[model samples]
Target: MSTTSLTDRLGSLLMAPVHLLMRIIDIPLRAVQKAAGIGGMAAVFLAPNMLIFGIFVLLPLVINFVYSMTGGTAFFISERNFVGAEQYQRLFTCTNYLDPMSCQEDAFWTAVGNTFWFVVLQVTLMIGVSLITALILNRDLAARSFWRAVFFFPVLLSPVVVGLIWKWILQRQGLLNFGLYQFGIEPYTWLTDRNWTFIATIGVSIWAHMGLYTLILLAGLQAIPKDLYEAAEMDGTKPERVFRRITLPLLAPNLLVVVVLALIKAVQIFDEVYVLTGGGPGTSTLYLTQYIYETGFASTLRNPGLAAAASILMGLVLVVLTLIQLGVGQRSEKKGKR
Candidate 1:
């Protein structure tokens, strides 16, 4: 090599160690500075979010509990001067608490029962329908994208809009009736009938929800290893056996996720019920949340105290349910690990 080239090459080789040492020396300090900066920035940014949460969520909860204790016209009353569990007692005992005509029994408890049934039915239907849709979409079906979009379209629509649309469609003179007319069948009042109303609401909820659940299950299906299915087929396993042994076991985590989400959504249903039936046809579709809203805001009594008590009770129930779900999930994970 020429002298200049030789010297340049030697300098580069000598400088490499220095560069490496500098990088090593600087990394920890740079990392420490970055972490500190991020910590400080996060604190600053989260202050507003924390304030908003306290104002909206935490404050309402605290106020609810406080109000639940106080009795009568004035709102600001001391917890010491509080009526204790009288609110809870009245929730069951007092016929005039919310509904005057329904005085023989607690409407709150009835609403609770109805809400539980609604949740159970809707969650089961939602998970089942979504799982089936997900499996079909996961296969090498024609117009896959079109089918996915079609299935998920309902999820994009607002619940209120969906309820309104379905209400129109299910009316005696609506699309359903029109189709029935062509078939020479008598038109039925879907919303007017109690059993039919319940069924209609459940159907609408399932239709609106399947898209999201299907998407979630489809993602899970994609994550499953292809080799498992191949091995199952190689062993001469029937399709049913393959699904039960391979697909179900592998999809357990996804199913759990869909179930939990469906449960929460079903339990908290309001808009659809409100728009479709307005908790009407003789309180047939009156859910717990609707009861709470009506008691707190819509009714003439407007007992904030009772509403708060009901809310706290509902929150406790939700917390317990969530804990149960978590426990189930943990057990499943452990089993999977084994």
Candidate 2:
């Protein structure tokens, strides 16, 4: 080799160990630098979301609590001037609190009972109907996509619009009455009868809500392995037996999600009730939410404190219901594992 070439080779050979050593040292340092960068980026991203959550959800909850403690229509006062849960007490104790319109009697406990009934009936019916619809769509039927779309389309429409459409249909001179007249039946006031009105409201709500639930359940159903069903069938299991043994167990998680969602939505139902019955003919269909709205904003006696208490109570009920669902789900999972 030439002297220059020989020198260059010798230099490279001498620096190789140094280069390797530097790389070995840099590896840990680079890892530490990357970790720090990732942590900083995560903090930056999370900080804004946390701030927004605090501003909106947490702050409002705190404000509601504070307002509940204070005896006020407009101004915030000391909790020492607090009525000491008198508002809550009155909800149970008060009787015959008449609406100014003279159209209905508004009893707090009665409204609470009505709301409970509404939630239970609506949630149960909504979930059941959705599950049935999902099962139907999940089957190997002709025009499956068409049927799925037909079922799910109602969910895309706003609840307000659904209520209005149903209202028009159930009107005295509407399609329903017109059809009934062909059978020589008189036009019945669907909205006027308390029981019928309640049923109609539930029907409208179910129509609006069932589509979303069906879609959710259908997705869950599709995720389940077909092999499981085939295995069940090969073992001489009937269709119902196969579904019970295979599908229900596998679909437990999705069922939990569906039930909880239904419960929450049913409890929070306001729009359909508002539009369909306006909580009326009487306060038969009047939900807890209607009570809150009327007390806080619409009525002659705008009791923010009372409304806040009702809201807080509603929140607590929802939290309890969710916890119960989670507990049941966890128990079911443990049982399945065993």
Give each model a TM-score: 0.80, 0.79
Residue 216 displacement in candidate 1 (angstroms):
1.0
Return the lDDT, model 1, position 307. Answer: 74
The digit string of per-residue lDDT tens for model 2 on 20-44 reads 9999988885776587686575665
C-alpha lDDT of candidate 1 relative to the true structure: 0.84
Off by over 4 Å in 2: 1-41, 75-82, 94-106, 325-338
Task: Find the 10 residues in a row with the least total lDDT in model 2.
Answer: 97-106
Q: Candidate 2: what lDDT?
A: 0.81
Q: Candidate 1 at 6: error in angstroms?
A: 37
Per-residue alpha-carbon lDDT of candidate 1 for residues 128-194, written as tens digits (9 for 90 to 100): 8899999999999999999999999999999899988998899878999999989999998888999
Residue pairs in candidate 2 whose N, alpha carbon or C atoms collide under 3 angstroms: none
Question: What CA RMSD would candidate 2 show?
Answer: 9.8
* lDDT over C-alpha atoms for residue 89 of model 1: 73
